[model samples]
Target: MPNSTTPSSSQALEAVLARVDAGLDASLERLYALLRIRSISTDPAYAPECQRAADWLVGELSGLGFAAQARPTPGHPVVVAHGPDQAGPHVLFYAHYDVQPVDPLELWHSDPFEPQLRTDANGRQIIVARGASDDKGQMLTFIEACRAFKAATGGLPLKISLMLEGEEESGGVNLPPFMQANRDELAQADIALVCDTDMWDRQTPSITTMLRGLVADEIEITAAARDLHSGMFGNAARNPNQVLAEIIASLRAPDGSVTLPGFYDDVAELSPELKAQWQGLGFDEKQFLADAGLSLPAGEQGRSVLEMLWSRPTCEINGMIGGYTGEGFKTVIPAKASAKISFRLVSGMDPDKIRAAFRKHVEALVPSDCSVRFIPHGGSPAITVPADGDYLRKALSGLSAEWGKPAVITGSGGSIPVAGDFKRILGLDTLLIGFAHVDDQIHSPNEKYDLDSFHRGIRSWVHVLASLAE
Candidate 1:
């Protein structure tokens, strides 16, 4: 039997932690250097910054004993790198280097790019900048972890393949095609490790187990051949805006549950195990609401805040536009009004069926004088990572050993398209192990990643790799 001793390992970990502590300054320096690059993928002006970020990653990967390269996609370049060993189960590590734009820059405590290390009023020293927490901070957690392994062990504890993309924030336009084209090279991994999710709380680590599915579409309603002044047409013409509002309003009831025909037909309710797990989390809804600047649960009347966010499905009108206003509003009954609507579906929900149901609902609602058309976007089904899977047990063991506490297997409220894509195309299960926190403020101004998360994240990855080998 394998020995159950940890004294030697504990010594090694302490020694590694010491090296990590010593290297914190240099790590922050590297992070600041990376943050300095304006890798805003959405803005065409920052294309060079994107390339520079990829180049920087390539250099780091090469320096860390990997054959790394910056390969161009239709959009910004993707940073690819791999370990020398091919004997172990291949694991693909993922993180996005590109960050959102730091607009309305006045809200920041300091310059967005010109990062500074400062202690907040609470005495927590944080790295402040635009990309500090969003992704550059999050991505560096994995990279810096690899750095520590190399520093202490002369090599990584396991073989790693990195697929750091640039277009995650902007809907991952090129990632699918990029992965598809490089299927032979990318899909060889036994599993994928996505480190772009949030922790349960600041102090508690989490393993994301489920991601809600998404189906988006725009509905255009036409009531007249052309716009007509409300004064001239008064009581004679149908106002497309009103019609649109009624149709949109009809999709939900007072309780906030989606009222679309058959919208809940395929929704899977939370299992007893899941319910018990979430209940055991001890998450205070009041505190969570306070953070979000709200007091009431606005989703479903009978569900917990965690349920509303994680397990329950929702339908929301992303945007709506009708009529016109330059300086003052024009009292015109517009010929057409559109509402961009989307659905967050649970497992067992079929996107096609939901689409059909929505179309039928709209068709039934619109009168003969009014016409409606639907534009379909790509839809994906929800994914549930088996909590009882062998990999999860091993992964939790690894995380527990590192964090000195049980890792929370949580559910992600948002959609991660790649996870579903991997399930469909590669058949590889994703282990959502990330070190991000709620305050990281991804996609918001003044995004920042925590320093401790960065240092500990690397060692955590090392432990996970070790666990996987067993």
Candidate 2:
């Protein structure tokens, strides 16, 4: 086991952090080198660039004494690295090396592949590039921290595994299969760590503990045999548009709750401790709505916006297609209307059960003559790391110590399926810790990673790993 004494451990942590501070410039140079690789996994033309990125990671990890290799997949390569086997907690670190396609090239001030350090209007020194804040810069923070640990000491404090994928920006269709095939190797870790997330603010660090799952479904309703002219059959025929509208409206109540039968049967309520933590976040509901050009809280009245976003299950209409939608109006009632709907599920909610309830509700609302068909897109369950886990407390304490503020436990309103994959396939819970800011503009033109975030991010990991080693 690693040393847990206060004085020696503190001194070791301080030394590692000092090493990170001294090596900042060299770390930036290394990050810039990786950023220059155009690893756009979605585009077939950049396949070689993706391979180059995987190889580069393999080389870096291997130099760190990890048994690293670029494993091939149907689309891109996955870089798997294993650190020295030691008698301590094992962690699987996950990050992506691929970047999103940078369209609207005119918007970028410089080459997307050419990373530049410049001061922003806010007076923060930022690194600008396509994948600066998304994953490249964020991922490097951990690697640099490990470098510091090895440099300051001699080896890592614990067992570690690295899984770097080149197809995260694209659909990670191959990752689940890869994990399943290598389950025995990957599942040896006690926990997982992911860095593709953002901080609460510039000064406040946050760890996302809860991630809502998703269920996407498309439904088409047919009322009449063919399109009918309103002038020719005004009130004589039924319009599928109207039928679809009523059915859609019937799914939600005036109080902004789902109308499906027993929809909340399996829903779990927040713990008192978690609820109190969320209340302490000082979230402004009006400001949040104002930013979105909305003036009202639209879901489950009497709940805070943060609660609705982070903890509650939600049903929303994503899109709808009915009747004619063109420049010139067409006076015709279309024979078919389709709507795309999605549900955000919390812990204890089953996606299959929710889907079945929605289909049953829609079927009950349809007219006897009308027909409805449901098409399923995808589904995944919510992920929650036990609040009382040892690693969570250690990581939170480490983050708090690094940022000079109490690290806030937060939740994501969207899904990160890889976390769920680790749970289902590897039986490991993931800690979603990152150092990017809310305005990093990831996947957009002129994306950036704050210099402070990068520097302090490495330091944070140093402390976290040291704490976890205890």
Candidate 3:
């Protein structure tokens, strides 16, 4: 057993936070070094780069006095490390070392692999790179905090375990199996810490209390044996393009409601208390739409934009392909048309049920002598952490003290599958905290992480760890 004494001295925390502030430059250098590696997990061509990233982390953690190793998975490797044990809560910190592929390279002002320090329109100093804000910078915040703690106090305040995966940017096919196989070793933690979410705004910190689920499907409609000339068979032929369009059009009603039968059967309404709390966030829907080059809110008629994004279920046609349009205009009706569709699910919604309903709706629209095929993709259920738990209160208090404002407990419009998996497989509740802002532009060109966020994030973790230890 490790020492059970908790470090309750406010002066100790202050000293650690001061060390973090003083070591900010070295930390940025470390993050820049990691960001330079092209660890794109989706493309098999960069497998070696992914291994290099994992090895780099292993070296850094080992230098921090952690027993760390680069453990190989079927896909990219995972880096696991353990700090010297203390007798407080055993906590697991999770982050990804992989990043999304940067395409449309012309849109970036600088090379995606080169980390650059630039000032944004608002005069905020930011580090621009492909994965600067996504996971690299965010993950480094915790490591820097550990560094500061070790340097200031000579030890970590609690029992700490680190799990950094390299397949998060992809579908993470190897994660569930690995977690299942290593449950005994991995699940001994009291709670999981994740930094893959966004803050409420630029200056306000936030904790992601809920995450929407996802269901993806691809449908192909075949009308004729081959392409038919529009002039020759314009009226006689049933165009699969038109059929696919009509099927997509019929998915939602005029009120912006999904028409699929029982789509909302399992969905539950937000509690009045939760709704009140969301309303208090004072989200500006108009500003949000303006930033995206829009001027109106378009979802269910009555719900607020936040509710539509974070609470309500939605169906979106992600992509569609149909007839020909090469040079001038090919007057041909393609025999086969296809579309990719995805749904954002909330609590109580079953991904399987929603997928089945979508297929039924499409099959009913198929015309005579025409065939349709539904290709399933992936599905995951929504994740909800206990907002009233002791762990949450401790984290909230810690964040509030660091930022000088109460942390907003919010829901993400996006899905983090590992959050749900941690709960389902390891029976561990994950506390999702991050310093990324809405304008961070993650997974897009010109992605950046604010310098203030990088600095304050490390300090915030120092406080959170101290609170958890207490």
Candidate 3: Cα lDDT at 5: 32
Model 3 residue 139 distance off true place after TM-score fit, in angstroms = 0.5
Candidate 3 residue-wise lDDT, 238-291, digit = tens: 999999999999999999999999999988888899899999998888988998
List candidate 1 segments past 4 Å from native.
1-15, 324-330
Which of 1 and 2 is ahead in lDDT? 2
Q: Against the hidden true structure, what lDDT does model 3 obtain? A: 0.91
Q: Which 10-residue span in candidate 1 carries the lowest summed lDDT?
A: 1-10
Candidate 2's C-alpha runs over 4 A off are 1-8
lDDT of 1 by residue, 1-470 (tens): 21121113656556555666778779888998999998988999999999999999999989989899998998999888987773556788888888888877778767788887777677776777877777787778778867876787666655688999988877788988888888888888888888888777766788898899988989999988999999999789999899999999899899988888678877778889889999999989999899879998787898999998888888988999888846877888899999999988877788888888888898898989899989887788888888788878878887887888888889978889988877776777898888877777767666666776777776676677656655
lDDT of 1: 0.82
In model 3, the Cα lDDT at residue 244 comes to: 97
Displacement of the residue 35 alpha carbon in candidate 2, Å:
1.0
**Number of the top-ranking candidate, with TM-score as the measure:** 2
* RMSD in Å for all candidates: 2.8, 1.7, 2.1
Best to worst by lDDT, what's the order?
2, 3, 1
lDDT of 2 by residue, 360-449 (tens): 999998889999999999888999999998999999998999989999899989999899999999999999999998789988999999
Clash pairs, model 1 backbone: 133-447, 133-448, 133-449, 145-458
Weakest ten-residue segment in model 2 by summed lDDT = 1-10
